[model samples]
Target chain A: MTERLNEDQPIFIQIAELIETSIVEGDRLANEQVPSTNEFAKHYQINPATAAKGINLLVDQGILFKKRGVGMFVTEDAKQIILAKRQERFYTHYVQPLLQEAKRISLTQEQLLDFIKEGFSHED
Target chain B: MKISATDLNKIYKKEQALNHLSLTLEGNKIIGLLGKNGAGKTTLMRLIAGHFQPTSGQLEINGQSPFNHYSITRDVCLIQENYNFYEKFTIDDILKISAVFYPNWNASEAEELVTLFKLKRKRKISALSKGMLSAVGIIVGLASHSPITIFDEPYIGLDASYRSTFYDLLLQSYQEDPRLIILSTHLIDEVSKLFEEVAILHDGKLLLHEKAEDLAENHCIVSGPVKEVDKAIEGKQVLHQSTLLGQKTAILYDQEIDGNYDSLTFSKASIQELFVYLTKEEVVKHGDRN
Candidate 1:
């Protein structure tokens, strides 16, 4: 986790995405208390404010909620919310680019579909 | 604590160390003060720490001048790379003395750090290795708990592992007690992520002062065929450009990168890359005249 952050985007956004990934993978269940901002800062060697900003972004989006002074907790529907969000962006983030690259290589739609099916079989 | 410098200028003899610099920093933040050699990062920090009076302009900490002002100076600790201590004093003696000067200093924390850094209490300051001396400075800076702590290349001779430990300790202490921290180091890549704000100086002048996140977001590198790259960077501020055969790569600043240019590839320029390109551009411009 400490080595995952990169300069490709804002660190805060990456931090947020890491938490979201955990929630989506069910490693963090609903109402589970997340690590405090200070813990994240120390573990990641990042500024506490940057860690707070990332956590606050999740809170603002209803993916996490604060419990006064206790700490932040994963929302009950965090996985659903994250899945919906990613689904909405799937076309632009994944499908559109995949399609563009396929078109660039002159791969027909049928060939692309066949390739994707092969990819799924390999994954299993 | 809030520090505001308006049109600050510092001159040593005929050399201008800082020139017409204005900046404001407030609240709890870890700000990275970045610049090349002799770019006046130390001069600006010294002015803020009340070591030297600015040749001209106002430098105020919480609306009060820091020069010879004990009230402000007590709250600010400026630890330089080559810090000098009484050669006769032991490591414990130095820590005790610092605890007296910095009212907010935590003795227990200092002791823990001393042990962590593996410094002998009875060892005199004059007998320590360069890396050990840097560790002592790190201990003092972290345990001082000053509102405005400034570290100018605080770890000069420390090894890679020690440097990593220093960073971890710095973050841990800052998280325990939030304060305004200004860190100036040439090793920017190792610590760039720890900065909330970044203030870059080039030849005694303020180049840019902005949020670290925004700095990473606003700058990028675009690469492709020379003609495509040229067309993509038209009317944009290109900080640096290089060409190999027909392939061209240019670093763009504060430019909206259009993804519609399918032939071109875009990648975010890291802060260290941006700093190098930005300052190197000035040097190149200066060399052209000579």
Candidate 2:
């Protein structure tokens, strides 16, 4: 996932989210050593301090931990921590927007649920 | 290393190149010095490099004036866009001279970078193309490893690929031995992300100096219907605004959009957009007087 960072948000937050997505998607597993701040800076062509800020955010949240002079490593509960965090914001970030769009379109709640079911069926 | 300028002013005959400009830069950082042409960026850099003394005010590098002070100037390396190397000297000869001038100069790194940029060692300075000359400057700046390095539009005739190479090499060198690096360039969008802090100059004055992340967090561009946009931006510091058809878009500084405003769409104002709008507003204001 070599996607470029977007301008709509802070680069460090985007960097943190990228790492979190990797953890949740199983691309980076528990206890795995993460790339150093310098590595992230060179890859994204961003300031190393900015990249360090991103890694430190995860460290503050306990999703990652630093080893003295070694490197950063994913915490054992990183996936669970990230999943729970995302789920906590799902209602506000996703559901609220979905409901607002549906209201703007004058779609009834029943129609919205049926449409979601149909969408799920297509996935199956 | 620390650089502090207090009420610094530099005037050239009838022109006021710098007007009471004061800024402090310390520690190891990659700072972006941004401004339009004739905005006093070069004057400021030259003062820091000890090229000339300021007309008034004080500039200190580590508690001492940089002007004619070898103790301070020796640690500072300022590479301008048009570096005037001896036309008769070959590329190899210039590097050798630089090795003698800069005490911390890395000969091996300079040699490697010269090869990387594909310059002929035996070619005289006068025989190189414009882009080749720029590569020579870049090589010197990076290999010097001076504690306080300043690059004022270091990339002039270099193409896109070579510019990218310069940025990479700059970061690599900084990582190896952390130092204060001041970069001044108009190509904001391409290299803005590399700066830990950004300082914008306008009309020989300091307009803004803040952390890059803080700037990204506080400034944004919001657009929507004229009435809604007007309502959304009321009481906020609007740096720049435009209207087309029935829609209005405005750049807001130090203001955040509330999600309650459903009609308004907001996006972060990139450093380039912010610089343009911030400086453009002053130009328009000046134009009104004329």
Candidate 3:
């Protein structure tokens, strides 16, 4: 794998994050086999040991499971588990910041509700 | 599973291909054998495969010399880049030959990959494109299930999608069988992940054989304002540099850097750049013993 050698974070951590997001986004589905450690290495052009470390991190978090004679598969409850983990990061990571921005902008609840409705319309 | 190469030397006229090169590969892990053009990568592969004898040294696979031993040859499969096949023979005929040679040949696995690669068994090997021929070679290599398999630059003319498919299949096979695999390639950005240990060669000599993570950890690229980057990178071994806009980006060789700096981003060094620096005769790193 050709690793991205940016100093912002360790390459292994980036790999772990990518794999985690892959699972959460359904890029790698529940119960479906994911790439082998070496496959991750080749896909990203990284060392196999580093790839294995990233894979093992997901395994450690119960996001993925290994099948003997086969390969790694997304955990059965991957979606629910990640959703719960994401939920645990609510106020500290996202909500409080949005609220602070809203206060700074002097935004009211009605205006925010209107903004949410507009966002929903844009998606459609 | 130990292979010892001692004082191995090969010369073609004035150019020394392999210069007294000797190293031992531990068993059951992926290894990356890397070097510049004409650095004797193919020669090493052929030598270990017993295709040719070294001028001065010998290669031993599992304590037995692979030279002139059909038993060892049966278990060792070396896939040369740009493999050539007989124009008259179809892919099926080659599969049959493989079945006879390799004791652990998996027919079902071969068939699956043949279809996965969209290979036509009835087509003559001479009719396949460069990529298709590579696919045929890969099918045989994976299906052979050899104890020790070496791929010398497998993805030469392949398209991106085909290359990705090759990597997927290689990983799947390795996971299932868990044997020794060695790959040599120049497209470092595309296939660096397949390596467990990287053995870099310079002038037909082994430079370093360490983990892939270590290679990235050992080097970085620093880019920001020219003044700041230059000041911070002073006295460091700069592999390459360029000025884009008002910023300067310098490639640093092997430094311990914790990921924390204002207005500066740290990333891993490209293996290609490292190769160029390593092959150059004058570049120096104060603490780099290798």
Best by TM-score: 2
Question: Which ranges in model 3 have alpha carbons more than 4 Å from their true place?
Answer: A1-11, A19-49, A55-124, B243-246, B257-263, B276-290
Q: TM-scores across all candidates? A: 0.92, 0.93, 0.71
Better of 2 and 3 by lDDT: 2
Q: Per-residue lDDT of A1-124 in model 2, one digit per residue for the tens? A: 4878988889999999999998998989998988899999899889999999999999999999999999999999999999999999999778987988899899999999999999999995
List model 2's recovered fraction of native interface contacts, to 2 decimals.
0.72
Give lDDT: candidate 3, residue B226.
Answer: 87
Candidate 3: residue B225 lDDT (0-100): 81
Q: Which number leads on DockQ?
A: 2
Model 2 per-residue lDDT at A41:
88
Task: Say what the RMSD of model 1 is.
Answer: 2.5
Tell me how each candidate scores on DockQ against the true complex.
0.77, 0.78, 0.25
lDDT by residue (tens digit), candidate 3, B72-128: 888898888875457789999999988998899999999998888888999998888
Worst 10 residues of 3 chain B by lDDT: B255-264
Residue pairs with colliding backbones in model 2 are none
Second chain TM-score, each model: 0.95, 0.94, 0.85
Q: Candidate 1 regions off by >4 Å? A: A1-3, A96-112, B245-247, B281-290
> What overall lDDT goes with each candidate model?
0.90, 0.92, 0.78
